[model samples]
Target: MMFENTLAFARKLDAEDPLKNYREQFYIPQQNGKEVIYFCGNSLGLQPKSVRKLVEEELEKWQNLAVEGHFTGDNPWFTYHKQFKEPVARLVGALPHEVIVMNNLTTNLHLMLVSFYQPSGKRIKIITEKGAFPSDQYALESQVRYHGHNPDEVIIELAPREGECTLRTEDIISTIEQHSQELALVMMGGLNYYTGQVFDMQAITDAGHKAGAYVGFDLAHAAGNIMLDLHAWQVDFAVWCTYKYLNSSPGGVAGAFIHEKHAANTQLPRFAGWWGHREEERFQMKKGFIPIYGADGWQLANAPILLMAAHKAALAIFDEVGMEAVSRKSKKLTGYLEYMLKSNPVMEKRIQIITPENPAERGSQLSLLVKEGGKQLFEAISAAGVIADWREPNAIRVAPAPLYNSFEEVFRFHEILSGHLR
Candidate 1:
C-alpha cells in the first residue's frame, strides 16, 4: 500500500481506520489548549476515560463497605485478581490458570527468578541481552549473587555485531548453543526497549529447552505492543508492566505468566506468602504452605484493589478490541510513520531509523538516531508539543499506539519535525 506524506492523505487513512473511534476513549495530553501529538505510549500510555469511574467504584466500596469490601462488594477484593485471569491469558496466549495480575514488573521478575533461576552442579550461567532494561540487569545480578555465584562469570550478555543496531536471531541461537552445557537459564526482554526490535521468542525458547535451560521473557514492551504465545512457545515464565501500552495508570499492577507445567508444580520453590496459600485451607491457617495451583501460587500479597481496578479498565478495552486488531493496526500505523519520516529529504539525510524495517521484527516504536543535533532535535520536538521519549547517547523514540493514536497525528508530527529541519 502506498502512503502519501500529506495531511489529506493522513486524514484519509484515519477516516478508514476501524480503530479510529477507540482514540476517543483515551485522554490525549493537551498543550496550549490543543492536543499534543502523543507518541510516548511505549513509556506511559494515556489514561482511559473509563478509569475514573472504575477506580471510584473501588473507592466507594472501600468507603461504604469498609472491611466487608473483601467479601461483600460488587468486586470483592479477595477475588479481584481472578477477574483478570481470562483476559490477561488471552492477551499473552496462555492457559487461563497460567496467568496472574500481581506486583510491579521487577518484583515479579525477582519472584520468578527465585523459582526458575536454579543453578545446579555444572549448569550455572544465564544468557540475556547486553543492554537489557536496567531493572532486569540488576535483578539478574542480584539473583546470581544470592545463589553464591559471581555475575561476571555466571551471566552471558549477548551483543550485536559491529555497527549493527539489533541482535540477529542466528547469533542469539549460536550463543545459546555455544554455552549450552553451562547455561541454566535464558532470560531476555521480549522486545528491546531502546531499539524497538522484537526478538524471536518461540525460537529462543526452543533453543533454551534443547540446551537444558529454562527460558523466560521480560515483556514490558512486548506485552501489549506485539503478539505473544507464552504457553504455545513453552516459556517457563514471563512478567510485564501494565502502565505502558496497556494504559493502566502510572506504576500500575503488572502481570506474570507461568507455563502450566511449572505452575501446576505446587512444590516448586518460591518466596511463600499467605495469599498464595490454597483457598480451602487459607482460613484454616495451617502451619505448612500449600500453594494455590498455577501462577497465583507466586503471589506474595493480596491484591491492590485500586491499582487492579485501573488494570481492569484497561484490560476491558483489550478484551473488546482484541490483540489481533491492535497488532494489525500497529503495523500499518508504524509503517506509515516510517514512510513519512523517510519521505522528508532533509530527515532522510540527517536521521537514521535504527529499528528493524520489517513489520514482524518491531512494534509501534521507531527509534530515530539523529546524525547530528540529537538532543537539540528532541528538545525541539518536545517544545513543539510532541510527547516522545529521549534515550541517552543519541536516540529519539516515538511510538504511535494503535489503540489511541491516529494517522493524522503521525502526519502532524512529521510536519512539525520537518519544520524544525527546515
Candidate 2:
C-alpha cells in the first residue's frame, strides 16, 4: 500500500488489482493525444469498445434482413428485448424474471407509480428526500397531481438535521412513522447525488413496509457502484439508468425490478402496450390485455437494439467483475482520493469535501464545498485537464470508477488542485 512516489503507488494498486485489466476496455479521453485523468464516471461513463461491434451486428442485420431481422441474424430482434434481462438482473441482485430493460428513468418511474402508488384518499402520501434528483422530484409531483391530489398536501420530504450534510437514519425512520397512517409510497434515491450518502436501503424498505407503503428506489447513482439486495430487502420496485456507472453510453435504456410477490398480481393496473402483452397472445391481437408476469409486464414497446446492444457490452464487463469485487476496490480508490484532497487543503483553503467521511456511506463520488472563487477554481481544474463536474454555486464532483480509475489518477488530479490552491 506504500508508494515510492504517488504514481508508483497508483501503478502498484493497479498491479495488485484483480479488476485492473478493465481500464483498457474503455475509450478513455485524451488531451494532446494523452489519456486525461477521468473522474467523472458518476456523470457520463467511458464507452466500451465492444459497444461498436454489438451495434454493428444489429446494423448489419437491419441492412441485410430488414424486417426479417426480428427472427433472424445472430441475435434476432424477435426476442431481442429479453436478451438484456439476465445480465441486468444479476447486476442489481434480483431474479431474472424480476428485472427488465425498458424506457428511460423518469418515464419508468411514472409507469411504476401508476400500478404501485394506488393512494386511496387519506392514505395517499409519498415520502422522499428534500433535495432529490430533479427527475425523481418531477415524477413524484406529476404522480401526485395525476391522482387528483395536491403535492403539497401529500408529499413528505425528509431533510437532514441542521448543519448535517447527510440524512440521519433516525430522521428517515421517524418521518415514515410519523406519516404511517397517510403514507402510501416511499420513493427515494439509493444514494444522494450531492452529499454522496448511501442510504440504508434495507432498513428504509422495512420501515416503509411497516408504514403500510410500497417502497421503491431510483438507483441512478447506486447501480454498478454499490452492492444491492433489492429482492432480499423486499423492495416492491426500483428503476435505474445504465449510462452512469454501467458505462452504457448516454441516454441508454434503463432497467427496473419488481419483487416476485407483485409479479402475479394481475389486479394491479398497468399502462400496457404490445410489448407487455403475452408474446403468444400479442400477435393474436387479443381483445383483452394479458400481461407477461413479473418485470416483463412493465414494458410498453420493443427494445432499442442499438442501445441495448451497447448496454449488453457494458453489462458483460460487469458480469466479468462481480459487484462485490467492484465495490471492494471502489472504497479503496475513493478513500485514497479523499485522503489526497484533504491533504491539499493546507496548501489551499478553497477545497473541502462535503461527502461523508464514512466509507460505508458513500460510493466513488466526492462532492467538494469550495472556500473561494468556487466556479473559477472548478474552471481552473478543468483547464488543467481534470474532468470532474462542478454543480451549482460551489461544489465539484469527482468519481473514480473502479473499472478504470486509478490511485495515480487521483494523485494527478490532486497535483492540479494543489497548483491552483497554493
Candidate 3:
C-alpha cells in the first residue's frame, strides 16, 4: 500500500478496504459542523444510520399490533432477541444456544456471577486483576458479602510485576495454581480496559480447570475488538456490552456465553425471573422456574426490544465483515497509530504505550500514559476536534476503528497532539 503523503495512508487503505462501504452506514459526529477525526470508537462507538428504520419498524408494530405485538411484529416482540442469536454467536464464536441478548453489561455480569460464582467454605476466594472496571469490582464485592465472605480476604487481585505495563500470562496461571484449592472462580476481564492488554483466555481456562476453579471474563473491551472462541477456549462463561467496539450506542444491550457443558446441568443455581423460563411452559404461569437451556436461563427480566434492535444493526455489519478480516485491519491500523506516536520526541519518552506491542495481544484501543500536562493535553486534543478519552490521572485512550475511523484521522490526531508538545 503506497501513499504519496502521511494523510493519504487512510485513503489508500479505504480504497482497498472490503468493508469500507459499511462506514457510510453510521452517523458521524461533527465538531466545527464538519466530521472530526473520530478515534474514540473503543469508548462510545459511532451510530448506525439504519437504526431509525429498525426502531421505526418496532414502533409501527407496537401501534398496530398493540397487545398482539409480542407475536406479530415484523421481527416479533416475543422473539426479537432470537433474531440476533446467529450473528451474536458468530461474533463470539459460540453456538446459538450458548448466547443471549439481554440487559446491560454490568447487569448481565451480576446475573452471570449469581449462577457461576458459587463459593463454599475454605474454597471461597475469587481471582481477578487489580484496577478492573469499577462495576465488576463492585459486583464481586457485593457478591462476596452476599455469600457471607469478605471481599478483601476472598478477592485476590493480581498486579503487574515491577516496571511492567501489563500482566504476564505466567503470573496469572501461577496465581491460579497457588490458590487452586482456595480459589472458586477466576473472574477477570478478557482485555484490560486501561492497558488494552488482552488476556490469554485459553491458557487461563486451562490453568483454572487444573486448579478445580471456574473461569469467566468481562469482554466489554474484547468482544468486538478481538477474536474469541469461548467454547474452544474452554471458558466456562463470559459477558460483554455492545456499546463499545460493537458500535451499538451507549448503555446498549449486552450478551453472555455459558459453555455447553453447563447447559444440561440443572444443578447450577441461578437468580432467575419469569423470562428465563422455557417458552412452552412460560405462559402456563409456571410455579417452578423451569429454566431455558444454556445462556437464556441467565436472563432475569423481559427483553428490551429497542435496545436489541440497536444491537441487531451493529451485529449485521459485524457479520458482513468477519472478525478475522476486522482484526487483520485492526492490527495495521493500530500499528500505524503506535508508529506515529513513537515517532514523536516527547510522547515516546514521556508517554508510554501501555497496550501490548504484539498485535495479537491487543485490540483497536491504545492506552497512552500522558505525563506532566496530562489533563491539559487530553482537553487540548478534544478541543482540537480529535475525540479521545481521558482516564483519571494520566491515561488517554484513542481507538481508530476499522469500520469508520480513517488513517487520515490518525494523522490529524498526530498533527493536533504534536502542536501541544513542549
lDDT of 1 by residue, 1-422 (tens): 89997889999999999999998999988999989999999999999999999999989988999989999957689888888989999999999999999999999999999999989999999999999999999999999999999999999999999999999999999999999999999999999999999999999999999999999999999999999989999999999999999999999999999999986686667999989999878888789988889998888899999999999999999999999999999999999999998888899888999999999999999999988899998999999999999998899999999999999999899988988887
Tell me how candidate 2 scores on lDDT.
0.88
Using TM-score, give the best candidate's number: 1
Candidate 1 lDDT at 273 equals: 92
lDDT of 3 at 91: 92
> After superposition, which runs of candidate 1 have C-alpha atoms over 4 Å from their true positions?
none
Q: Rate the local accuracy (lDDT) of all candidates.
A: 0.94, 0.88, 0.86
Q: Write the per-residue lDDT of candidate 3 for residues 95-209, one digit (tens) a residue.
A: 9999998888888888888888899877899999999999889999999999998899999999999989899999999999999888899999999999999999999999999
Cα lDDT of candidate 3 equals 0.86
Predicted candidate 2 versus true structure: per-residue lDDT over 1-422, tens digit per residue: 42333777777777888887889899999987778888899988999999999888888889999999988767788798787777777788899999999889988998899988988867899999999999999999998998899999889998888977789988999999999998999999999988789999999999999999999999999999999988899999999999999999899999899999999898997898889988887888878888999899888998888998899899999998889999999998988888777655464466668788888889989998887788998888888888998888778898999999877888888888888876
Arrange candidates, best lDDT first: 1, 2, 3
The residue pairs in collision within model 2 are: 70-78
Find the candidate with the highest lDDT and give its number.
Answer: 1
Clash pairs, candidate 1, are none
Clash total of candidate 2? 1
Who is ahead in TM-score, 1 or 2?
A: 1
Lowest summed lDDT across 10 adjacent residues in model 1 is found at 261-270
* Candidate 3 global Cα RMSD: 1.5
